[model samples]
Target chain A: MALQLTRPVLRSQPRLLAAAQFLPTLMFATVAAALVELTLLRLLSRVAIHIPDVPALRGVYSAAVQAGTVTFPVAALLAAALVTVAAMAMLPRAPILAIPALALLGAQAALLVAGESALGTAAHQWLLAVALLAVLFYSTSRRMALFVAGVGVAQAAGLAQAASANLAAEGGRALPLSVAGAGESLLLVTLLAAPVLVGPRRWSRRDVIAGGVVALIGAGMLFGNASTARTLALWTFGLGMPLPALLYAITAGAMAATLIALLRTGAIERAGALTLIVLGGFVPPNSYQAGLLLAGVMLLVLEQPRGPATTD
Target chain B: MKWSKPAVLLVGALVIAGALAGLTGVRTATSQAVTLKAVAVADKPELNPDWATWVKIPSVDVQLTNQAVTYPKGGGTVPAVSLKAVHHENTLYIRASWKDQTENVPSIDMAAFTDAVALEFPGKSAVSVPSFCMGQPGSGVNIWQWKADAQAGAGSAALAKLYPNGYADSSGFPEELTKAALYQPAFGLGNPVARTDAAVQTLVAQAFGTLSAAAAQDATGAGMWRNGEWSVVFTRPFSAADGDQAEFAAGKNTNLAVAVWDGANGDRAGQKNVSQFVTLQLSGELVKAKSEDWGALWFGAILGGVLVVLGLAALGWAGVAGTAKERA
Candidate 1:
């Protein structure tokens, strides 16, 4: 009887100790390292200290890019690992979703190994959408599941918009306004407002004060100078360029509220991961932003609260 | 170790502020080393895209992104463009080519859109490189844009060329009216798009939606479509009449960005594939110049510092206030 109890505990301990808690930390560290390399070593150095005449600094930039290239496949593999773990957890309960999830995980891993492009592009959008939908089966709450579904649909639509031009080139129909342009704007508002909508009530006085201060800083950065402010705003929100007046106001307000909610609810890590994923949507997967985004998605998948095993 | 909520918020704010400061110049690192070396030739290269010398000159293939931030944004039609550059005498010649199955030339029809491409360069007055997308305020950009319809007579004879069987009776109009400038206001006003004589337009933009015809129309180019591909060549002198245009000289390095539009995909204005800025080298040895703009750098550094100080102060205040409340 004691051996039996110890066996179950031993099995659970390996997973929890080896993969469960450590995975998110590993993904976060990888992402942090990549971002530091990209922003500090590459971009900031180029702007602040990397003089054009300095061949050594230029080499540093090249080295950073090389490092990013290597990190990309590793990041993809970790993402695949997360999906595999989630699938295995759901295998006995919901094989319908689990089997397909495993199949996508296989394809994604194969693509990564074959040096194919990352997910979220025209070629890989369908795979990514299906994988996201499959992951929704493990959502801890209906609201969270709905949110994931919305993100999947929006992401797929954005990818389809990229493919629309090729279709139109082949004598197919075209959209009047860009789905990506509108979708990004809508998503910015939605993401920034999500925490508030699903947040805990009764904000602490300290949290409110903190939120107010952040809101001021955000407003000042986004609405200060005409030239630099717009650039900063574009980067922060990752919304479509040439920011319209109405959309800009909406996003700014949403960001403020979200910041308050995040502080009040103390859901910093999850919100941070989601924010990275949203910001990554602005650029192609080939960019450093995509590397950060992949890490963010992996962190979220690993950190998600496990639901009861399905009986189906 | 257990961490307080205030400490986590403070740390998070610091990280975010630092990250944003570092990402201000993020787009600069988006592209790889794409050098369009302008080979020195003794004589002016043939204007044809199929020029023999072009075959000898190496080309740089630039990957393009169809994800535009502005309106009417849906494009990936031409995934990439190949660029080759050569200099003969004081003139610089650049050839750009991309794949396209259908040749689209704009007509007077409301639905018709022309295939177009443009090369954007920092204005001669710009102290630092501007945004790749139109440009930024204060720092402007000069664009040399070419259109298929302009090469084919700017939609004037496009109806006749596209539909040989379709006819309209123009004899009903009075002869004076037919010849009057009033009949073609845009062409009479020297609008580049309406003008039939030029295939390329010299334009300048301060930011998005700010593109306008430059005072000097010194640049010209032509486009040829064959074998399901379109190749366009733009030629301009090494120097411009004024600061509104981009000035180039041998041995000097400059940034070059390209935008391609597919008429079949209804790409126009903001809807087009764009490449990140790449280095363009003239015939002489590449010379990397030091930046002379210290004010902008100082401003950025100071702004980041201020944000860090402010964020820490606010979060620290929150922490102290929470501690006092607990003690009370």
Candidate 2:
């Protein structure tokens, strides 16, 4: 009876399957696009010796060319193509996944524009945004979406709380500024990864690896300069481990509890535990901010209980 | 398990390679040396004594008691004549000591404060002597010694003619005699008229009297006088032009030579040209001088430590990534 129920459910949820199949391909494409953009930007800088400045318009034009035209479009097209191929292969009739997928793509575009300004001239912001969007598309599901939205709300609330706490310190502004900056990046990654995490399918082995690699590379690029590396190393040594270690520990405990609970009753008690663990990690201001964000997203997606019918 | 061993070896090799690269950039030690010398000449009339016994010079002076005269070292066993002249070409040699550990002592300007020999020639008229050439004999010139004495209220009535500025009073006859005849004058004796031929006889007599009184005052001088063999050497005056001067040279000629013993202890001997009345040689070595720029090394070490931490972090990230991949 369980087998019979699973087969029909698997056939019905084609969008989730397609997203899972496309995750790795999308990540590889985004990385390729970023490399190409980086190379082109370097070449253009060498060749365009006497380019005229256009006041306020120059920054906008430069960013659009670098982030939108070069990095974003390439990453998006590659992701879209992979998703389309996977969808066709899995179940061509289900078009509902396209709605969330397209919405994920739009969020990627917005992220690219914002990131182009924030990450400075060195990074391929648009490519990173697209890669994030692909991760979200792969994970999309109602529960995962609500969890991602909740985490984003938590980060926003944290930023507001940091601002309010500024009055307690001499240079009160720094606490709020750091919170906003960190929270914004976390939000972007969460938003981009939401659709995939909340999707009806489980993550494949390849999907997880690709997701982890993309996240690591993105974090490294953002914080890998000499000054940033030194700051991170110093803080890690002086103040114990990175802030995300606590989150990992909590997440591990939750997972252990969830596993025990699942073995006995197959209930979704794990999701709540994992959520608490992720929240614990996200609370600290330390070098593990990126790790916490990625971990939180992963825990939210993986801990959700699947119905017996959807097990296939 | 087969793959694990090779992976571990590769990681070990990387760590070793990084450490080797860091060690290779370490800095090493390095050094350079410097030298100086001076000479004297005598006049025809002064040739009887070979002009070794200088009668007049503006910068420095030397007077020997009837018993203090001595033959040149390593020359002969004969006692030098106090009233007569003895000449063996006199030379003073000096070696400034610098150890390998010593740093930041540049070859340039090392001669400025090392050692110097000056010549003083007293005059009947104190006003005739230039300010650079007056001081106690054997003692170096104290360019402002007279001024210092005045400030101390130890002014002399006789020094009124010496310090026209009223900065100091006259020096007492016996004290002034010993100072003028035996040491380099604080003020330079640039003029021939300043060290009058007439004053030379009286100055020598006064120096003799002071020595006799000091001998009576202390039994040590009398004992040394009775036991020690003494001698004197006089050189001919080369010319008046050479009398009030200074020069630097190395090796053995008439220039004054200094030999530093046991790193810090030193002995000075000067040769003067009484004909022109100028300083021939002045040299010596001083110890315990300070080193330069001990700060920069510490700064570089701090910067290097920071670079090391970054390199380690890069390695750490690679390690974590490898583990994650293995688990996946």
TM-score of chain B of each: 0.75, 0.15
lDDT of 2 at A309: 20
DockQ of each: 0.03, 0.01
Candidate 1, pairs of clashing residues: none
Off by over 4 Å in 1: A1-312, B1-33, B167-182, B285-328
Candidate 1 per-residue C-alpha lDDT over B1-328 given as tens digits, one digit per residue, 9 for 90 to 100? 1344543443344344434434342121121124466757765687789887776665666657673355666677786897878787878999999999989987456788889999999999875566676766667899999999888884536677667888677666787885567997877787776677789999999866789999988888988999999999999999987786799988666778999999988888877888767667675522122233434543553365345334433443454455447668
The most accurate candidate by DockQ is 1
TM-score of 1: 0.46
| lDDT score for residue A260 of model 1 | 61
Question: How many residue-pair clashes does candidate 1 contain?
Answer: 0
Q: For residue B115, give model 2's deviation from the true position in Å.
A: 52
TM-score of each candidate?
0.46, 0.20
* Candidate 1 residue-wise lDDT, A13-104, digit = tens: 44333333333443344445445454543334223321454888767765664454344334433334444544454443334444545554
Alpha-carbon interface RMSD for all candidates, in angstroms: 20.3, 30.7
In model 2, which regions exceed 4 Å deviation?
Answer: A1-24, A27-100, A104-227, A230-312, B1-328
